[model samples]
Target: MADYLSVSALTQYLKRKFDVDPYLGKVFLTGEISNFRLRPNAHQYFSLKDDNAKINAIMFKSSFQKLKFQPETGMKVLVTGRVSLYERTGEYQIYVDRMEPDGVGQLFEAYEQLKRKLADEGLFSRPKRPLPRFPKRIAVVTSPSGAVIRDIITTVRRRFPIAQIVLFPALVQGQEAAQDITRQIKRANQIGSFDTLIIGRGGGSIEDLWPFNEESVARAIAESQLPVISSVGHETDTTIADLVADVRAATPTAAAELAVPVLSDVLAEILKEQNRLYLATSNLVKNRQNQLNRIRQSYVFQQPQRLYEAYLQRLDTASRHLNQVMTTGVTDLEQRLQLVRQRLLAESPTRLTHDDQARVSRDTDFLNRAIQQSLQTKRQRMERAVQSLDQLSPLKIMGRGFTYTTADDEVMTSIKQLHPGTKIDLHFADGLATATVETVKPHEEE
Candidate 1:
């Protein structure tokens, strides 16, 4: 046991050796990532392997957060980190601080990744603000000493002299450029009164124009309150700023032209419109005068009384026709009245009353005779019914010296109703007698 070293002790010795090794302190390695999976809020653990060898690699969340493009399994990457050993697992691994796609530059890869992400978020497809036809004042964001500002001012003054130009000076290159550009955009919007915003710089290489490609600059342009016209580089160059802006111009001069219209052309157009209006008004007045003169020379205007002649004749004829219609109507009404009077005389009240009285007298005499005959028939039928009912009456049978017996106050019609020792009542023609049954007598079979 004294000669044996525990596993923990051996692991600690190896870890110290790995940590202090000069070659392993800041190693630059290029390999394909394997078994890579994202771990939220924790360190990223994966394997990096080439065709010949493999090694375990881990990147802390802080370092992983700084990576612009997402890393996946089997992707080739270049990483800068140090080799270290884990005491518990007795395994050696690389701690990565920086990583990038193997072939492409880091900045370009980051740019493409951000662009895709924002496009997926619908930022690129968002409805862009429409540029105003005429801007009263414009704010330019760029390097104060650059040729871009000079070119914009000169072009604006040449095209639209009345329009005002204000410069919000900002760094347009290097790392701070993106932040400065975003700041200027916000400041311009905050101060207000600017109709348009122009952000640009002179033509340069991709690296020089990279600030405009930054995500902050792109987002600021997209979210700007004032319509932004981006003019970065020459006609062939396009940046993220250009895509997000309301309008893209090939050059700063073009941006200025887009901001304002040409004064001379506008003035000429106004003058032309004025001439057209004057001509239209003069033609309208002359035509109206010619129409009035033609109307004055008409025969109706010269003979004013003739205008109403047809109407007057129509009225006179209408009056005569009305008088004839009224006279004929009166005559017809008088004939109707005479006819109605004759009909009334034929149906006078006295004659109608006499006829009605004669009919009533005849009806009364006939009704009296019919009533007497009905009474005689009813009396004869009632006397015959009374005689038939008297012959079938039980009282008539009893009066013929017949008798009936009852038990329990009910009349007995059969001999079986009589039983020995049962009390009974005998009904005679004019009396009822109660008696006890001594014997029951029934009819004997012959």
Candidate 2:
């Protein structure tokens, strides 16, 4: 220790060594995360650790923005960055430029993370609104210079040239791209009378297509008042925005195709319906004509008098049958009248008048005797029951011998309720008397 090195001096030397050394400047590292803290300002401070050692690591807001999944403690990560020294704290750390989930593509990892989050929050489970079958105006959010917009325009023009297309220019990748895309989506909604929104971009690597996976962009799509169709990359590439959007398309062209129906196809269908109507009318007219021809060729139309001839023959046959039926009916009526007269003579009242009269007289006498006997019996029984009831009646019993005494509206059966000076009523057979209760003498049964 010939000369003690200052902290700044040592850090500066270390920084210089990190800057020049090929291995230190750029490195691809794999390790487990520890002591990870996500900053409020969108930066990450953490330590990367292995079995024997650990090193400080930092992910700035810009680099962290590219990550698909949030880094947490005990997570394995693969990071590509440079090793550098923090002169202030005299600590050497790795400044991560790019990061990916271990053993998984960053885009897929991000998709899973966003899917889980949105599913938990019910954004993905929310009822999706149906897109308008015939849109008045379709607003497209994509790169202004990319083939995605061109493909959409060409497809829409070929299918439905009548519908209007409005383009909202946005960056599909790079820094702040997600925010720009979200801003354009909102701005397009405010500035236009667009019935539908198509957000899309051309296919690319996950790193080149990270913006569409941002949570802000996904939330923007979810909250949009206009129905949003997300067409990101090819059919294979799905972004978080796709999950929350009202509809998802395989490609930009597919999105435009979904937005409007083909005018030529509709015209063809109309033409087909018109042809069917014409054929049906022609067939109906032909059928009616054939029926008229058949009627004209028949004997009735050819001769004209043949219609009356048939009626004349039918009238003759009906008249003959009617005369025969009338003759038979008169013969049957004469026989029925003769039988009825015979029955009437056999049942005549004059034939048995004496016997009927004697029987009626005998029955009348018997009925009168029976009624008189029954009435006498009921009267005697009723009288005896009345006498018994009279004997049981309180008034009748009291009339014979007993009397009733009461005090304070209660029968004087006991002395418990009576006081010495209480006034009482004594009831005999026909009258009651007032008496003072001088002493309550409790009666004992003999």
Instruction: Highest lDDT: give the candidate number.
Output: 1
Each candidate: what lDDT?
Answer: 0.89, 0.86
In candidate 2, which residue pairs clash? none
- TM-score of candidate 2 to 2 decimals: 0.46
Poorly placed runs, candidate 2 (over 4 Å) = 1-136, 158-163, 171-196, 204-228, 243-247, 260-300, 308-355, 360-446
lDDT of 1 by residue, 1-446 (tens): 89999999889989999999999999999987765656788899887776577898999999999999998654679999999998778989999999998764344556678889888888788998988877899999999999999999999999998999999999988889889999999999999899999999987645568899898888888778999999998776667888888899999999998889999999999999999999999999999999999999987899999999999999999999999999999999999999999999889999999999999999999999999999999999999999999999999999998999888879898878778999999898899888998997787989
Q: Which ten residues in a row have the lowest lDDT in candidate 1?
A: 102-111
What lDDT does model 2 reach? 0.86
